[model samples]
Target: MTTSSLEPSEIDLTDWDFWARPLSERREAFRALRQLPRPAFFREPEQSIMPTGPGYYALVRHADIVEASRRPQDFCSGKGAINITDMPPDLNEYFGSMINMDDPRHAKIRRIVSRAFSPRMIQRFEDQVQAVADQIIEEITAKGSGDFVADVAARLPLKIICDMMGIPESGYKTVFDNSNIILGGGDAEFLPENDEEYALKLLQAGQTLKDLVEELGRHRRENPSDDLVSALVTANIDGESLTDQELGSFFILLVVAGNETTRNAIAHGLKLFTVHPDQRELLLADFEARLPGAVEEIVRYASPVIWMRRTATRDTELNGQEFKAGDKLLLYYWSGNRDESVFTDPDKFDITRDPNPHIGFGGPGPHFCLGAHLARREIGVMFRELFRHVPGIRSTAPPDRLLSSFINGIKRLPYEL
Candidate 1:
């Protein structure tokens, strides 16, 4: 038997150039590397476009990624959950949410915030989400055509997240803009010319959100509204609640996590439907029968978040890949979603795909998405409304994707109904 091998260059997962290609092209590259021992390591180039680190392993196979997520004790996310070179400690802490933390800290935050996402609360939010989706559809219904990213895909999640937080309707755009900038990173469409201007814009965006949340938290404490913000502000476990900064960070996480990723998944749904009209027909034929599967497949196809980082807490071997304590690795969720071994016709968009275990959300771990149910509900509701309200809706052109390695985002997508 022959052991598969990979030239370091072929598997340099950190290369910005690698991510610059079409996602399909990037997936093909991962497929080409599949035989190179399930998990392969590569040292990234120094001082490139993105934050650079010493080196990291690429977990491209389905089994490898599942194992990494299953064993969070060994593959920890407390350090960072992104692939941005070497993120500064301050920045990481500022951007870090429960998703970026490991046990105890991650557990504590998760438990507290989990309160806001109870089934009863989510059920109540559903009617609001449906109304928001209708409002968004109404705003664009007569246009007959518009950039789906801005006009449709971006609206529902933005509106729902803001409404969930009890943010004033006047500030919906503000939350939407800030969430886009922070997640946009250095994308020319979102950031400024140089690193300095970009840094400043990014900081200002963070500051704006922090101040807004802080103000809202103070008001919620005084007024006590029936919303997630009020819930977070007053939430107490044995008389302990989130601090002002913690409240703000959690809000930021809610906006970014709940807004950007869900929006992207919705955007990708339109694009995917455009390409696979047959699948769309299947969905339309009997939405009740197919809605859940379609939602799962869209999340799988979009893989809205591309990958997450996990550091080896101690010397560990995954599928025979050697690792030292503190070693870094990226679990390529996008790649794993399309791994040939996992899903039949991994690249094909099948709405009825069953036994779909795609970790479009983080898989098999405590770090799994806290808002998964809400996101899925939002997607299902939005699409059901879209197909019903705008029966003739379709895209006018291919998407202009965000130029970032971390987010598999569609920056702009024109469409017509």
Candidate 2:
């Protein structure tokens, strides 16, 4: 429970201070964890929301994460995938989406919502993405320099998601702030100082998002627009349509997951390119040919959405490690992306790294990120516009990272054109 009690080499995943450490130190700690024969176990961090039940195993290695993801029946998500603590059923109305669900219900909701992200649907938004990226680039270029995160990286995805869901521009700030609070993970900048206010703030934020989307969903149900809300509220999937609560929860999942992860990826991409000029040069040399690889490398290197939890459904063994029913495991995707056995020179920022099987989106499972294709397009398009119009644009300082164990977020990044 205290830093003095832990050995220097024995990293405690549950410790909040461990997340506060510098990136390099955290990377070294995970490297040591990966070297271990089996996943490391740690007690749950104390929280006001739920009583600490059992501790969780840290699935830090690429092989272990992959196996766990592949065997969803053995390692289930219905107990709660986003938070390490057991989420109360009352909170599920706002926070539970397909990510927190297991098969049947998860599959049905995913099948219905997946239509909005299908290739045809994404192709329709391709022009919209380019237009938004261009608009953002122009706005930032006029200013010449500022916080790239707020100015450039955050705008594209937020606008695209809002536009897709028929959320008016007036509500963009609401969606943005609420999403930040929902995933803020006790960051002081986004949360109140009083611990008593924490749960209330979270519930209020979730309620705001739910109310915003449910109201829009009601309108879409009546008016029937060409947006995702209209499609989702009306679409029949095996004689089942998403209820208002389902729509609201899915909207929270979509906006928060879609907006924050892509924003961080873009922020991290600029930082990575700024640090490794050679890779930037290689990317700029043939922007069209090499960009696909660069985008993948960015997601791999950034590894946004640090980890997701899975509960053991039955007693089973994974890669030589055994788990009892109701056991908890945190799959550290960032660590998996850096596993030495999988990636050669894992620390290097190689834009041309081939066959990169990074689980930045997520491991191979039903819970893999649904917005990945959209995220890739958003990242790729934004960079293309930046390289074409502002080739010299780069981060001027290290990022102000979010203080969270879950999200690999950059709160702010000073940049120049």
Candidate 3:
């Protein structure tokens, strides 16, 4: 419990080493991170004020991330949501989502969503996912080759979420476009610029999702169906149902969560396979047995949900380092995934990495990712179909990483499907 045993000055938040290099050069960065004198998570990278105007400390060590994630009380979620953009202060209360709440409120919202992603709820989607995967692969295979990002990863998740919400086929593109605008707003291909233009684009995206949620809520209210929107419309929480604002925020969470993360996971998963072709062939050869491990490896390698933010509720010591009340902490899950202390040969994509404790979907805590099962199901199915039908689903062009340091990932992976 000696506080400065691990000096705060030793950490480097801007870790340009791994982040600066292209994808092909990232392994060296991970290797270098492994050789650092102390635990990388405990390393203090440069601190900067966020666009939202809050100051935060970024945590990179595996143990520290696990501790922060598990201790949601002293470290609260309300510090901010996963993104850095400022939520208009006046509208903050309404945007109070499960991802942005602490303790009881966070648990409450999670329970409501759990209803939609429970064992029974998720089971219903298995056949649907396989079917969609089959049809899409059939088209891609016939064409012989195409950009996997466009031909596959970007297509399936929205369709699945829309089906779950009973949304019409036409709404898929709008939902997809809006998520890209909000989540990848800083990515040049997605939104182009990071000035006021990007902020305006995010507001526009929020308005679109807000409008869709309102209309969907109204429809479900009038003529209830077996879809999630309908189920939520009639859902009672502590004998009280979701109000319009609650309904809107929850719906936005579902659609955004259901789509973006899964898409990134799949796209990034495929890229990992391309980089580690040996592992790719190994999974394809014994797919049924190796597929689950392959999924874990991809999640570990990609770490799609790069980081999640927390606010310090009280003056405390994390890993024996002092932090003041109201200080922001950015828990870098990406670094945790590659922690050498946890995995032998952490940089290599081994489909056989047993005891894979990667924090891709996050770990034990109040805000652990709820959509993990669905993500695994979706990514597993997509890879299965890609290997089976696409023959050689490897990248044909160099992949482009999204510009935003948050939720960092590939923007375009031009693969020959």
Candidate 4:
């Protein structure tokens, strides 16, 4: 299919209305886009906060996203990876952490911070994750039924991240609210009504998170603990440590990305199981043996992060398509996860799906998710507890989906015990 052949009215990735459609329609639209000869170009979505750029190629295929991720020198992320529009200079300090940085700088930060997220560190917290999951399940059982997102799914990641950072329980709600605002920019429930107030609100949210972490970082420097904040503040890898601003930005990235992505994955997991009972039964039959595959399938099927942006540093060709320097491309991870060429019957949620090379965390690269192991542990433990305790739990109604092109978020998912 040619660009002209597919009208914008029929399918426009940039349109907010397109994202607001039912999940099935959006999946079908992407299925059609994948069959195109080359990635289709669409005008950037208009925003009151930032000026629209020329346009961006939607990298819908798995191969294209993987290639782009591998060749970061050509399709760089330094400009911006989270947003299609260029992030303003002022916002970069808060929003532009290693995810938005190119090599050398990105490598440096990742190297220092990598120690905290290493497998050993994650394993040390394994019992903590299980404990938290048990507590959450107990609460849900006591409450009987409610919004799963709040009572169950959202609590685990939020508490885990906050505990890792040495944040007090008093600040948990603050972190949760600010992170939602940061990621839920397109949602009216979390954002202001006025268009002009959008940027200001975002800045405020970032500042709130930045201040919270900076204060903890300072305290950690004076009185260190076994928490991630303590490790980061004093981490000296070849005479390099995270600066206050860097610490703040990294915290924002960690809390928002870590909490939001894992939360959504769990939320989507319940709904997926509710819809596909056979998969749930298959999982429950032998959860210990099947859970590892189940976690991978959950991330694959319900790609929490919808897409990430990349800009061409110089002229490049990917998958036989030519592109000029400075051109923008949005790597639609959601589409890549569902590529028919990559996974057999990709739409079907099979817990025992072997060779599942899903890019839900992201395509393989320096920018791949650092907290992936921890996320898997959280989801696995949470579900293990749910299946053991609330054996008959399922979604009572369809998820109240978040209206955003970026995050496949479920604001509220009603459930019963």
Report the Cα lDDT for candidate 3: 0.73
Task: State the TM-score for model 2.
Answer: 0.97
lDDT by residue for model 4 over 36-100, one digit each (tens)? 88788999867777888999999999999999999999999898999888877547646969888
Ranking of all candidate structures by their TM-score, best first: 2, 4, 1, 3
What's each prediction's TM-score? 0.94, 0.97, 0.88, 0.96
Model 4 error, position 8 (Å): 6.6
| lDDT for residue 28 in candidate 3, whole number 0-100 | 43
Q: Which residue runs does candidate 1 get wrong by more than 4 Å?
A: 1-8, 45-52, 86-88
Worst 10 residues of 4 by lDDT: 1-10
* Top lDDT prediction, candidate number: 4
Query: Given candidate 2, what's the lDDT at residue 192?
Result: 80
Better of 2 and 3 by lDDT: 2
TM-score, candidate number 4: 0.96
Cα error, residue 104 of model 1, in Å, equals: 0.8
RMSD of 3: 4.9
Model 1: which ten-residue window has the lowest total lDDT? 1-10
What does candidate 1's lDDT look like per residue over 1-417, in tens digits? 011443334545666676676665676677876767546777755543356677887888888889999999998887888643656665665666676778887777777888767677788898888888888889888778879989988888888888888998999989988889998844778987576677788879888998998999999999998888898888887666888878877888889988999999999999999889999899999989999999999999999988888999999888777789988888888889988888999989999998899999987889888889889999999999999988678888989989877788999999998
Model 3, position 276, has a per-residue lDDT of: 80
- CA lDDT scores, all candidates in order: 0.83, 0.90, 0.73, 0.90
